[model samples]
Target: MTEIETIESFERHLRSGASLRGVVLQGLDLRGYTRELASVVLAGSVFLGCQLEQESVQAALAQGAMVFPPFLGLPYLPYRSGLYSTEELYAGFDPSRPESYADTLDARIYAHWSAQGRAHPVSIVEALAQRLHDHAITDAMEELLAGGGKHRKVVAIMGGHSMLRGQPDYRGVAVLARELTRHGFFMASGGGPGAMEATHVGAWFARRGEAELDAALAILARAPSYKDREWLSRAFEVRAAFPLSAEDRPACASLGIPTFHYGHEPPNAFATHVAKYFANSVREEGLITIAKAGIVYSPGSAGTIQEIFQDACQNHYNTVGVVSPMIFLGREFWTRTRPIYPLLEQLAQGQEYARFLRITDSLEEIVQALEEYDRFHTLSTIPR
Candidate 1:
C-alpha cells in the first residue's frame, strides 16, 4: 500500500473521493499557483496560511477566485479558522463578563467589519475568509444535491436581530419554523439573534414540538431579550432540557449557519448544521436570492419590511418560480400597523403583475397556502 505525493496525483485523489479538510500551502511561491490550485481544488480545502502574491493574487482574483493575504494589517496577527484556540478565541472574549460580551465582542466585531468598508485585505482576512468560503461552497454543494437549481426550496425568515431566545415572538417564530420544517422545508435568515434564532430553534424542535413547544418557550422565557442578563445561558438550558432520545435523534434536519460578522447576536446553537459566514453582504445577498419558497413576513420591524419588498420584486418577476408564496402571518400587523398586505394585494391585482398572494393570521393557513400553491404549481407544470 502506498500514497501519492505529487500534485497531479493529488487531483486524482480528490476526484477519486479521498477527502481533505485543510491543506498547507504556506511559503510556496505561487509560480506554480495553477498546479497548487489544482491541488486546492482536489483537496476541497480552504486556503490557510497560503501564499499568493505578485501576479498570483491578481491572477486568482481575475479568475474569480479569492486572493487575500493572511491577516493583512490586522490589529491582531495570524487570523485562524472559525477554528480559534480557547485562549485565541477568548483572547478577544471575556466570558466572566457576559454583559460586556455583547459590547466588546459582539458589537465590536460588526463595527470592525463595517469600518473595513468591505475592502478585501488578504492579510487580515485570508484564513478566516478561506474557512468561511470553503464552508459555504461545501454546503451549497450539498444543497444543490438536495434541491438543485431554481427549485427554490429554501425559505428565509428575517426579523429584528435583537429578538432574545425566549419571548412570545421568539416562541411564535420557532413554532412556525417547526411547522415549516415538518412540511419538509429548509430555513435561513440573517443568522443572528431574535427571529432568526427562533427560526433555527423551531426547526431544531421540529420533531419534538409534537409533544413540546410550550416547555421550550418556558425555557426561553427566562431570557426574553437578546441583551438579557442570561440570554445564552437560558438557550443552552433549553437545549439541555431536550436530551435527545435514540429514537428521537434522527428527526427533521436543522442546518443553520449563523455568522460572526454580527457576532453580537449569537448564532442559534439549535441549527444542527450551521453554514455561518463572515461576509454579511455576501450572506445577505445570497440569502435573498436562494430562497425560492418565498419569505414570510412576521411582525418584525424595518428589516423585515425591507425583506418584504425585496421578496416582492423577486416574486413579481417570478424570479423564483412565481414567487412561491409571500405569506404574511399577522393580519393586524400587515393589515393595520404597517399595512403592507392591502398594498401587495393591489399590486398583484395589477393586470401587468400576475401574482399569487395569501395574507392570514392562522399559522396552519400560512403553511397550507404554501403547500397548496406548490401543489397547484406542480399540477400546472404537467401537460393537461
Candidate 2:
C-alpha cells in the first residue's frame, strides 16, 4: 500500500498519473469532503471497505450516489460474459476462478467487481460499442418515423424457455409472431431458447410461414429442451431453409429478436437485432419492462405466468405511464386453462388498473386494441 496519508498525498498521487489498482478506504473520514469532490475523485476508481465520513455520505446521498454499498449502474448485469456455463446459468454458478487474465471476459469483469467492493466505470468506448451493436433498434425507429417502415410498436411474446420448436403451441406462437409482424408491430422476446427463440424465428421468416416453419419445428422436435445440443442448430437449419438477404427479406420486414444470456442455447440468428445482457434477471426484467408498448402472453408454463402478473403489476400501477395493450393470444389457454386475463379483469374491476387491458382471441382485434391504446394515451413519466 502506497501510504497516501493526507489530502496532499492524495493530490500528489493523482497528479503523478500512476494507475491506482484499488483503494483501501475502510473507515477513513471522508465526511469533510464536498459531495462534488467525492464523486469527482472516485468517478473512475474502486473503493474497498472505506469509511465514508458522514459528510461524504450525506454528499453521496444528496447526489443520488449509493453511499453504503456505492452506486454501480444496474446491479443486475452480465458481470462476466462467459464465466457461467449453460447449466450454471440455468441453475447456479460454479466457484469463480482466481483473479487472473485467463478465465473469460465476463469472469475478469466480475473479478473487478468482486475485488473492488464497488461498481466501477467501464471505458466509454466500450459503452458506445454496446450501443452500436444495438443500433438496428434505433435505426428501425427512425425508419418507421421516416415512412420507410411503419410500426415502432414492440410486442414481446413471452413464454417458457423450455418449450420445443415443433409443438402446437410453438407453431401458434410463430404464426402469432409472423402475423403481428406483418401488421407492422416489431416482435421481441427473452432472446433465449425455447419459446423465445421460436418467437424470433417466426419474425425472421415473417413473410413465409409455409411448410418451412413446420420443417424447422420438426427438426427442433428431435431436441425439445434447451439443454439439448442439437436444439440451436435445428433452429438455424430451419432458418437456412429460407435464404434471407439484405435486399430481399420479409415483405413487411419485421424483426425477430432473441438474447444470449442463456448463451448455451445460442441467440436466434434470425433476430434483426439482439439486445442481450449477461444477467438473466436483468434481461428478463428488461424484456418485460420494455414491452410497455404491448405484450402478448402466449401459452406458456410458470415463467410465462410469472411475467403475466409482473407485466400486470406495471400496468396495474401504470408503472410506465400510458396503459399499453396487454393482449393474451390464446383464448382457451388464457381464459379457461391458464386463466390469466380473467384474473387481471377480476383484479381490475373493483380495484384500480391502467384501464387499457384487453384480452381477446382475434389477432386483428389485438393489433387494433394496441393501436387504440396508442391513440388516446398520453404517457406520463411520473417518478416512482
Candidate 3:
C-alpha cells in the first residue's frame, strides 16, 4: 500500500498514473483535488483526518474509500505525517524570556495533555486522538530511520534526567555520544535534561572539534540544572553559537523519544528528530526497542533502573528477533552504587545475550563494542 502524506506526493503519484487503490492519504486537504479524486480508483483507499468537501466525501464513501473526518478542536494534528523538529516544537520560545516557553508548541501540547488527564483521558475522543498521533509519530520515526536506503545504526543512552549540566557524568556521556555519532552511529535518548540532553548535545556537535564542544559545555554550565531559569536559554545560546550546517545535519542527525508523561521536564533541543509521544510506556519501550545496535546505561536512579530491566527482558527472550549489546558506562555505578550489573549478569548466566553484556568505565570500550557488534551484524545480513 502506498502512503500519500503530502500534496507533492499525491500530485506525483497522480502524474505517475498509479491507481489510488490501497492508498493511504493522511492529514491532507483534498478540497482542491475533487476532480482528481473523482477520476481515480478510490476502492481500498483510506483517508485519515482529511479536509474533503461534502460532495467529495460522499463520492469517496460511495466509491469504497474509507474517509475519516478530522477531529474538531484538537491542539495537535492527529494524523501528522512526520516527526517534530526542534524549530517546530520551540517555535514560540524566546531565549531572553523563559516564560515564553508556555507559548511553544511543546509546552502547549504538554499543557493540553495534562488538561486531558495525562495518561488516562476521560473523553474517548481525546484518548483515541492521542493514540492516533503516537501511531503517526512511530510511522514517521520508522521512515526517518529507513531514509537513505539503509537502516541507521541507532544507539540509545539511558540515564537519570536529574543529571545536571557541567557534571562529570553528563560531560562524559556527551563525549561518548559525540564520538559514537562520528563513527556513523545514530544517537537516541529520553530527550529531557541531564544525561539525555548530553546525548543529543554530543550528536549536535558531531561535526565540530573538541574545543568547540568544551566551550559549549562551559556555556551550559551556567545553568547546571533544568530547574534553573537559564537552562533553555543557555541551550539556545549554544545552538546559536554552533548552528548545524546543511551538510552536517545528515551526519549529526539523532533521535529523541520523549513523552508528555513527565510534563515538567521539557524536551531537549539537541535531537534532530523528535518522536514525542503521549504515553511514556510506549515511548520508553520503543526507545529501548529501536536501539538495535546497543544501549549504554549511564548513572541514573529509578527511571534508569527501570529501563535497564526493560532492556534485559527484551534481550532475555530475544523478543525483538536479535539481541543487542547492553553496555554499562560506569563500572562502579552499575556494580556497586546501583549494583544492577551483577544481578543482570546472574540472570543471564547461560543466555545467548550474556556475551553481549559489558560493564566498563572506558568510553573507548563502549564505542568499540558497538562498532564491532554493528560490523558483525552488517556482515551477517549481507547476501553471500
Q: Give the top-scoring candidate (TM-score).
A: 3
lDDT of 3 by residue, 123-154 (tens): 99999999999999999999999876788889
Clashing pairs in 3: none
TM-score of 3: 0.98
Tens digits of lDDT, candidate 1, 237-286: 67678855656544544545455565656665565555545655555555
Model-by-model lDDT, in order?
0.60, 0.56, 0.93
Residue ranges of candidate 2 with Cα displaced over 4 Å = 1-151, 248-264, 350-355, 361-364, 374-384
Q: Which structure among the candidates has the greatest lDDT?
A: 3
lDDT of 2 at 87: 24
How do all models score by TM-score?
A: 0.68, 0.57, 0.98
Worst 10 residues of 3 by lDDT: 144-153
CA error at residue 125 for candidate 2, angstroms: 17
Decoy 2 TM-score against native: 0.57
